[model samples]
Target: MAVEQNSLIENYSIVIVNVAVAVIHYQDQYLLGFRAASQHQGNRYEFVGGKIDAHETATQALIREVSEETGIDIANNIAVKLGRLHHDYGDKRVCLQVYRIEVTAQQYQQYKNLSQGLEGQKLTWVEKQKLLAGDYDLPAANKTILAWLQLPTQISITYPLEHFNNASNPMTVWVQYHQEHLQIGALVYIRIKETGTEESINQLLHLRNDIKAIIPYNFYTEKADNTVINRQIVARHLTQAQLMQCSNGIAKNDIPDFIIASSLPLVVSCHDKESIDAANQLAKACLKHQLAPVIGIFLAPVEYTQTHPDTSPLGWEAWSRLAELADIPVIGLGGLSPVMSDQAMLHGGVAVAGIRQFFK
Candidate 1:
């Protein structure tokens, strides 16, 4: 699945397709079907879904697809929009609207013994870790799906100050708060926006062993490569420009393997469709190069941010549009509260993220 291949689509005006793919999750396992060798992109493990009918919504198509393929009805289940992917298979241009629905133990067990889909396609349950590790052979576009799967729905990003705005030792307070949050299983992005990110990450790295962090790339300069940053809390953030650089490197086969190979995952701060495209391209490059793909992206300014006062927020409507373009998980950031996670998910975001609201 990680082998690199050359398949270029020259024509840009081909008819586009809408496909509804489901990632049915149960106890850290995802249900997948093994395509027959006669099918396109055959012999690979794939999620069960099909082209959406002209008369149906994405949800309607997904419910129908899952039923026809797996004999499992998802009409009553809550299908959360995971991400959207637009890919060209040369023969077909497809826009995949991916959704994830969790099944209970009873439901999983009921279908677990089936061994094959209703269409006679082989079915297997890939473990969460194996899927995340890029173990199973999947279709090329599924590289983005693997990256998105690594992410937790809830994320917490640190601010210079959350509730303690007046503290002389605000970074200290942030350190304590972030450590506590991480210990409790909150996936926190270690960013100290006010006093600078470097020193803050250095401090956090030394304080604890259990800290799960996503460091950011320094927004101040292009000189700082993947090697420079503490690889901290931004778990180093990539701008669209930076992701473009990686994409270019993948083309030339000259990019360093550290970022592509590291335990640290790339998370981009995307404000528009173009940025999401850049990130998606980088994910494809990683899969091509047999390296670790981008983990996810942060789509920000869901509301006005007091920290970044000048940058306007992308409200729910605009944010949803951008999220629909992202093939990776999109965390709704800026001026958001934990309570808004559901709202974010409803509007195509994987989760809501923030400093002021979430930290408090």
Candidate 2:
């Protein structure tokens, strides 16, 4: 009877395995294919690849799958592992390992013409903007992979500066820091802490010179709803009160028109599950207003000095689960530092973000 019970459990349980997916990028666009209309997720668009064979590496599986699906041989070394996603489809559970496959412009064009759907699926090249704006419907599980692709690998946030205007050589500090970490693809965010007032507004402009000195890629000011500056990504950090305001704005279709017209991408911060849900809701609202939404979360507290000692950290497993739920690029915050950047990516973070990590 015990043997029969064990057999029943084995037979009823779902099979677990890995699926390799290719994210082929060319000319600021990505390659995606439509699933066959008869399959389980038929008539939907997805990154193309197949199952990983027994004892096969992710790269080996990617090369084989790309060739079989698109008739293009992706060089093994050129395929960079982005991240992995754990998904369950009731009867089957899978770890979808995604890779970024690189190809030359001429090679991409030639393959675009020559590539045939080996599995009777339709293939198309899509711009990143279209993908973010919901131009195509993707399978629920694959959304996390798309979001991961949108995030920068490194992020640096500023520490609160109450005496920046009186300090000497502030710009030098910024210049030296940028020179040291220039190659890391870092985005700088100037944290905004203020109430509406003339003195506070004037004080805010003190860092403008230092900000301008940094290279003009991915630099932005946070909590920027009141002012629109040049060459900076305007942002808003939502608290409980502001979140209710956002909800009302979305419901009344009253999110300001400037959001849709602004070229700067929007970043939203989430501290807990309630804020995470609010961020998700705010993202959809941002999309409706033609704004790009990126979610930031405080997943862990590394040191007692950083926050409450009794507060439990989310750790890697919980962080990954919460990030998957975001369905948009997520920046890992809280206790993260430069050393844990790679580990952050492993657990589904688009980038490692912190105040002390990049600033003193």
Clashes of each: 13, 0
- Give the runs in model 1 whose Cα sits over 4 Å from its true position: 1-18, 54-57, 86-95, 104-106, 161-174, 181-183, 193-203, 218-235, 239-264, 273-292, 309-313, 357-360
Local distance difference test, candidate 2: 0.58
| lDDT by residue for model 2 (261-283), tens | 54544566654666666656665
Query: What's the lDDT for residue 341 in model 2?
Result: 70
Task: Return the lDDT, model 2, position 283.
Answer: 59
User: Clashes in candidate 1: how many?
Assistant: 13
Alpha carbon lDDT of residue 138, candidate 2?
88
Model 1 C-alpha lDDT per residue in residues 1-360, reported as the tens digit of each score: 011111223465567677889999887988989999999899899988998877778888889999999988888877777766666577876777788888877788898776888889999887899887878888877767776776776777775555566778876776776666553545677654454645556666556544456765552232344333333332456765666666666556666555654644578777777777777776656555566556677888889998789999889999988887776778888888888888888887788777656543
TM per candidate comes to 0.74, 0.52
lDDT agreement with native, every candidate: 0.72, 0.58
